[model samples]
Target: MSVKKTKVHLISGFLGTGKTTALKSLMAQKDPNEKWVIIVNEFGEIGIDGAVLSDNGIPVAEIAGGCLCCTAGPQLGNTVQKMLRDAKPDRLMIEASGLAHAASVIDELKVKPLSEELEIAAVFTVVDPRQFVSPDYAQQALYKDQIGVCDVLVASKTDLCTPEVMAEFHEQAAKLFPPKAKVVEVQNARLDIQWLDIPVIEKPRYRLKAEVLPDNTMGFQSEGFTFPAGQDFDGERLTHFFNDLPKMTEGLVRAKGVFQVLGTWVWLNWVDGQWGANQVSWRRDSRFELIAKSFDADLIEQKLKEALE
Candidate 1:
């Protein structure tokens, strides 16, 4: 009887492949009438994408840790529900983790007791310049699913490679999909609002099974830490402390959590750097959680201890 109040725009991509860049670009140009909320799988335990947007004065809701398709479903649903209730955004953009399967995300769009106000807008799958060619390429079922479901396929960093490679790349890649999706490579991934509304048939819903990860290489545990009233931490000091961690963590996949430094809550992110110096502050959310793929728990525990000391 009532029109859906918001449409969900799912932006699925792998880690560090420019989904954040595209997302921020689109959000900044939005008309105020079109309030947009972003659900990022990574809240910058590495880069400050979310913090930068929040600092620029745009509202972003992040559901990080593991892949959204696998790990953050409840958080994703709850965040969406809250956004519809509070901000009533004209569009909702969810940036799935690089490891995330877009099919699982679509199935989630059809969640039980579907909210009356939520409409499925479109699915955008982002690919890196090098993604389609790597040995790791075939391992990326998430990437393929991302493409198979997209109303728009965004190829980020097209200027860095040749048209021949890009074209051949697409031709080979096309074998992965049905003949319905469009692939458009961007110069620097400059996205406009019009790109957000391409129409495609709604995909068949996906079902997910529980995956038991091996304990040896890449798995993570999350715990919430709360600072009592009047607690204070030095932000600059905290950043430098974690920066020294890269040397200690060699096989680590990713690790990040929100914690207090100088009384301001900051997100600490890491992605297997030789050193953790590449980390940046998201400057939001007091609550923190960590995700690791192939990290040794003892090594991570040692690094974490060094951070707090």
Candidate 2:
């Protein structure tokens, strides 16, 4: 009997570590004819990564509101089955929530139905180099667990860090990471496509496991709004509104959406205290998704309505 196999790349990182950016880079290097499927698990209810990849015409499956390793495990299994049955993808990549522990995901994939079909290529964990030098890096168990589970260590956002910091990061990486893992550094999360083909030996699973909804994700939440067609947002007004959102909404972390602006469409993203808007293809509905620790959704909706009016 012949067994069917699909290569799997599990990408893990914390919030704002640039897993999506890495996916974009990797996708650009893909052969046009090859089919790749992405399963994005997000901690917040509003899924931003899925939207971004979908915009680029990539097939994406999103699991939102909690970590796939915990709350969305069943959904992950179901999604995998559907993707294999319908999409018949050449490869599969899972972008785990920043707050998740990859060991659970790996163990999940190892079990029947998925295990019989999947050939895990490598486990890649992206890290911000700046975090290596921070005292909090050692203190945060989630971060430690994320790193401990990966077969490949990816240092992302290297372009923004200093040479001294990079050197220090390498020093720390040598000591803390699994001896067999390969380390690579990238700016803007742009990793080499060849790295995906490098086969890896699976590490032992983590013994300590948390419930599907981990404590770290308790403070995170999301809200979304949809505007009907032709009820376009004013571009200038929208920019100002997003700029003022962090100040107006307590615990505001990120806000993003594709909006019909002045008869055209644009993608707006407010993240990590900065905002950017770029022109994108048209979508039927103009919608916004917000992620925050705890914010008043009514106030946000009212403020946006006022801006449009």
Candidate 3:
């Protein structure tokens, strides 16, 4: 009997860094014969990434409500162990929370039962070039630590960044960090599969914090609502609701979820100032996640409830 060791890839990045977009591209190019599993963790209580990944027909496990560094760590381990026992995938990919500490996740993977059956393939850190211009981001601990912990650095959304921003990021990234295996730019999160083949040789220098990660430490809050199972939202009404979200909610950052729309389900996504929605396969529970720096959760919930009425 031969033992199969699953190759595990950890995808890390700050919020809006295109980790999910990159995963979409990778999944599109997956070999037909290979069985791959993805575990998605979101900082928000309402799980959105799992819905997005589930559209691809891949096996997905979700750890939501907190980061893998703390609250979701045990869930992550249990999910991995179960997947290994049942699915027996050829590879495993984890999309951790944007604010998550990659070093802590790696530390978790290296412990006990998971370490016995899994091999660390690569840790990829995604960067949004636009963030390079933010002086505050340069000062953030999670942003800086995310960069420090990856074997490969991927600058995503290249098409959206100006030439000068790209040039500046390239020059600064090279000078700032320790030498890594690879640093590449990807347009629309189109990552190369060859990078995934590289084995993890050097572990990250950032150590996991011994203390519990403080609540709302990232200065962002998430409020989510689950709609009743039998209710269905009118498409026009839902669109109107999302269109008005940015204007109504104070400090609104990102919103995502699946809603039951007239016997069909549609996924709506909003980030920064833009919103988009598309019809998707049906999901029983209709819900939404609102991420903000500050907001009146009750008011937002009222607005959504009225929209469905």
Candidate 4:
């Protein structure tokens, strides 16, 4: 029997969502016998999270200047491969960018490079305790999507919010989240480190261990599309499309992409929400890729078709 225990834990949230604190807390609570490989990605040029995890002796591999969902895809994948080859750690934790959408990250695992080794254990998204009460969150599309897609949603920094505020936020967030994922509060900095030890990535008896790219996307049950540079279109309309998506979404884990078009080519961008073109028009081309655990592909297709048409 193979003696390798390769499982991946993805921690995704928007900026200042307390991913670092949650990771630090989780690492501190974990048993020393359990070795962990942390893959951290951020927009900042320097790798701060990796250094923090390093202080805890958790053998960290940081990938800076990109979100773990896309920019750091190869680096994260390679770092993970090397870790397995060298340290053979018991578990892996991917501290994704605060802005990362979990659906896209999980979708990457379903296809190439990562599928060979790593298996996702759990998906966690950290919510800033204060944001739920803020007017910005109440109106923002990304805020709602981040909370809705995670397998485990944490109302972090409970100490700051009053009991009533916490309770109301919990009720509101719970209503927005998927029925399957569990939501909890992390106030006392207490976390059940045991969850990592539980073989969370369910192994399929007959799994698809194959390399996938644009052409072979559909077979994986998690994939997206990319249009050529000439396919540039309206940006505001695109955003409006995604903004209205949350109402009809089903099984959408996470989705984000960077695109380019004339005058907008220099400014590469991303889209993450229930109602949006699952693409980014950055290079004068319409490139969009979406990854989901399981979602209403037909509905997504219908919407995109309507928007593009």
Q: What is the lDDT of candidate 1?
A: 0.58
Stretches of candidate 4 exceeding 4 Å from the true structure:
1-5, 133-135, 138-141, 197-309
Q: What is the C-alpha RMSD of each candidate to the true structure, in Å?
A: 16.6, 18.4, 17.8, 12.3
Q: Taking the tens digit of each residue's C-alpha lDDT, what string does model 4 give over 143-253?
A: 655654455667777888887888787767654412214567876544567655443222211122233222344433454544443344466655665565555454444
Which 10 residues in a row give candidate 2 its minimum summed lDDT?
A: 204-213
lDDT of 3 by residue, 71-124 (tens): 887888889999999999999999989989776787688677787898777788
lDDT of 4: 0.60
Worst 10 residues of 1 by lDDT: 204-213
lDDT by residue (tens digit), candidate 2, 1-309: 977688888899888999999988998898888889999999999999898887666689999999988888889899999998888888998999998877678767867888789877777889998985688885676786677667678998888999999999887777541232588998778989888877553222121112212255466666667676457687778878888888777677657776777766577888789888765432335667676777777887887787673
TM per candidate comes to 0.59, 0.63, 0.62, 0.59
Distance from true position, residue 166, model 1, in Å? 1.5
Using TM-score as the measure, what is the rank order of every candidate, best first? 2, 3, 4, 1
RMSD of 2: 18.4
Worst 10 residues of 4 by lDDT: 200-209
**Candidate 2 residue-wise lDDT at 131:** 87
Cα displacement (angstroms), candidate 3, residue 278, comes to 46
User: Among these predicted structures, which one has the highest lDDT?
Assistant: 3
Please give the TM-score that candidate 4 achieves against the real structure: 0.59
| lDDT to native, each model | 0.58, 0.76, 0.77, 0.60
| Residue 157 displacement in candidate 2 (angstroms) | 1.6
